[model samples]
Target: NVEATKTVVDLISEQMEKGFEIPSDKVITVESSGSSDNVAIINCCFGHRVNETMGRVVALLLSARKGRNIGIEIDPYRIKLTPASSKEVLEVIKSLRPEAVPELAERALLDTKLLQWKIIHSARKFGYLSKDLDLSRINLRKLVIKLKDTPIYREAVREIFVEKMDVEKASELISQFGKSIKIKVYDSLSPIGLASREHAFDLLMPGKPVEALLRIFRQRLEKEVTVFHCLNCKYTVKTPIRLIGDLRCPRCHSGLIACFNARRKLEEIPKKELHRIANLVLSHGKKAVLAMNTHGVGAENAARILSKYYENDDKFYLELMEAERRYIRTRGFWD
Candidate 1:
């Protein structure tokens, strides 16, 4: 196991030394399951330290480049986040700025929706009107919030729907108002709420490798949750953006969701390159596993071997549905 881990680590280090591009391998797939499963571990944190899972993703990138098949497995239970109650987080809304809340969520590896609800609370504090959990129905009336009885913004009361705004555009608009009143506008846009979430893996479940791997799982598995509209009925529902999935509105059950992938949300920020580096670290660990893999699976099959274990995406759910049908045994309740 130690020798196997060392070989993959050397391969990864060579790639890292090559500056993100692993030395091109002529082999399309190298299938070898001779090594022990325990060889799947590695010592890497990067210049800044990375979790074991994060290292697997880094190894995956290398796997793709090297054509060296590796078995990457993931455990769904390791990455679960405890949901906080709405009221509990509402108390912290005032102390945190609209932009800073997502940072809090990101640091904790919490869902972006967690920050979404908090933004709504802060918006309400600034006297903006909202009627949705996601704050998709927010409206800012000019006179709703005033400092010393002065209108927050002399501009006509309007809806700066966050779905239609970007971070820079939102920031520019918010700056029209004074610093004291900036957050009100910021609240409306929910810039961080609408943007993509980038997980901070190393900090979560410190010293645990799977926690690190889950971070990479998040990046690869994360989907853009978008609002879809039914043009025929004028009804909308939020759903995932998928190339091979249906987007039907639950309300009408008659029309397909027309807005999948149509607009970028308020909180969608691009993953930093450092995060990619973190993923490389994750991939390396997986490579280590492959170096010692005893599974006897074919080469091409080795890629995404972890998919069955990591739960996310419609594919996993579909598999679950199939399992339930095949194994449930009874048709009715209380069998």
Candidate 2:
């Protein structure tokens, strides 16, 4: 029996050796899972991103091992004990048991730290979390805008801000809030420190030299949606979180901090204000930062933005799972 398992493991190892990029450091071994007779597990599990890849690997093992392709009849061939999936993951979520996230992490066969962060971060995006889940130390500076009056166009701008970009929603927003709203971006351009004061350009003030403003905006916000100042050096840069390690200041390598949230900056604003912002950008001969609709005023590559931030480091996935469990017990399932 042990030899049969070993043979299966060897065939898998051989297949992995051929073309797979599975790490050499990973120990391919069999162990008792307590619930099953024998199990072959990847001790260094990569998580949910590897779902399809694992499916392919298993399919290859079944087809190539034991001399010929063997078909095992079953309702569904489940992959268990992988970071991305397992028997417990499917059963736990599918049954709507309201299991705490850590429990879910165990069921999913993922490291608790990495899993907790991923789930919490994802949940927070849509305002689902009961409290702020700010485990990540990524920082940025941002400008916040609030609509003057609740215009009919408020819905449209809100939709754009969130990057949902629904045509019908936009149209509905246009009809409801379209031309009636007025928007005002804040007036914090007065630089507090000497450096900002020296180059202190008033971006919020309407009808300033459009060309200079356009150049300044371009310089500050390119790959980054917005710009923020460094806490220590006061150097301005907007960097992605994944590349946070590379975000050291050119001068002092000090920390960067954001005053406001770049994404979803304006929670609720009037439609006319959204229109004004678009027109203001167009008048300046600059592309509207939030592009959408026929004129492309609020359009965005929504998936690209989400993909950048939703990345997870598997080793530290659910670092807060225990905290989450305790929180849930104190309050209720929604927590």
Candidate 3:
């Protein structure tokens, strides 16, 4: 079973690298019995650094290995992932299936041009209109209210609304006020051009800084997407195909997923049966992969970490899976 899984993962990776098409015959499905605690426990210190889609795949495999079935879940906003051991479990599953689809976060950030301009315009209105309004003690909400009532706010704002202030600081202020006033600030703004020179601080980097790097990558090329599903609620979501960071689901909060690789597919086994799946992807720095979207280094990072273990050799994926099983059994982490 381990070897077969590995073969699938490696094959998938190779096909992706070669820009080859995925063969339907090669697709394999693994199901969970929906049991909790069947998933392994992992340290959450670096959880934020992990991928969401990758996390789900690890959780699913963990559940399957333990012979316990538990679906994963996600949150409403689809930002952060929930559940523990999501990273480790997903990695195991990703090692088995490498042809999954891309995630929403993976999609390129919407053009923030209009968003930035509007924010700056709003801020200028508040700052200039209030220049004589004695805004020192006025909280942000009251300031916005005054701006709406006074045309002086509009004239004052229109004068100083430079495109340069549209980046982070301007956006941050606008977003803060946007939330307070329930106004759609971004809808009125336009994006400024980036500084042609790396040293040019004149033009600002676009979009939210948190996902900036991922956004840049999405603009440049195509990448693979990792899909995540919850064992408890059966909620499903995909990871950004371009980002190498997270791979967990955003709903129902489950981390189980079937990740695709060129070799074997890593599946999540329950805590009681973690002995079967732990060591397959563990190494000096390899955080245990989970099927949940919220934990670990995430699918992209996990793939880089466990890439050494992936191979089309008949026994490679199986060997790692068995090694994980042995480690889990011997470690006695599960009761």
Candidate 4:
């Protein structure tokens, strides 16, 4: 197992050294004399670290050259290229400035979710951050900025490097590229590479389609509870939109009801404002209830949306969808 690990690591190192290029449409595979299952395990374990290390190295270098962030997937046995060709990647590798690695590595970690989680977890362990802190309430980028030069941040980076990556070995192999190691491309994956493919992890890229976003928005609306306040009697009731049917207030028998998110406290709101909301609901009817029930849309915004004329229900819904999308995109900033 030890030898297999070293062999897989070395194979990955060679591939990274060559800038991860194979013949067009051809796959590179590792050959082994050992049991295929053992080879697979070795590839999964060590190959991942090697590929990840090299992937970071290349990604950082490319990002520097291009003046923008570049993303890449580090498969168990390969470093998937972003917008760069094999030749360009090889040039970047060849021109690697060893002195810049520490800074580059740190920069590479900035956008990684793993590093962020590790930083938070380590901070909690060291009592720098509260153990029960609500992760959703904090801005991760700001947190990282605050902890950048602190011991907690350094410890997190160290743990990631020591426990999960073979950056030093990868660097050494890259340094020895021409002298002791060389690239060998293959037409297809070998038996061991095929075995490695059996347990490969899935890569999930970001961004959702408009339809998917709308579907999610619809689901959220269905589950959302709205507080209905009767202006006449000051009686309030909370009901989920999915279960809400009757529009009339049971206590006052009035259709003049103000709608708010269930989280809103009636006591905190001034009576005059509550009356205004009630008037809004009375004027717009069910449309005002729906607008208020929409995530992140307050009474004023709902009023603006309800006041606008739409050609049809579809156009009105599309406007609501845009409002929801805007709210989603900016909610973190709001927090």
Q: Report the C-alpha lDDT of model 2 over 180-224, residue by residue, as the tens digit.
A: 322111111111111111211231232455455455433333334
Candidate 1, which segments miss by more than 4 Å at Cα? 1-149, 154-199, 210-226, 238-245, 248-335
Model 3, 1-335: lDDT tens digits are 55545544664576456443332212211211122233222211111112223233343455556555433321111111112233334344334433321221111111222222232345555455322333323354444444443554444333323321112222222233223322111111011100111112112233234245434333432243444334445554454434534433455433343333212222321222222122333332112332212123234333443556545432332333334333322221110
Per-residue lDDT tens digits of candidate 1, residues 156-231?
1112122211333223322332343321111111112111011222223235455344444334323545445454
Q: Judging by lDDT, tell me the better candidate of 2 and 4.
A: 4
TM-scores across all candidates? 0.18, 0.19, 0.16, 0.44
Candidate with best lDDT: 4
Q: Which residue runs of candidate 4 sit more than 4 Å off their true CA positions?
A: 1-46, 97-100, 183-335
lDDT of each: 0.29, 0.29, 0.31, 0.62
- At residue 319, give the lDDT of candidate 1: 37
> Candidate 2 lDDT (Cα, whole model)?
0.29
Q: How many backbone clashes does candidate 2 have?
A: 29
Error of 3 at 278 (Å): 9.8
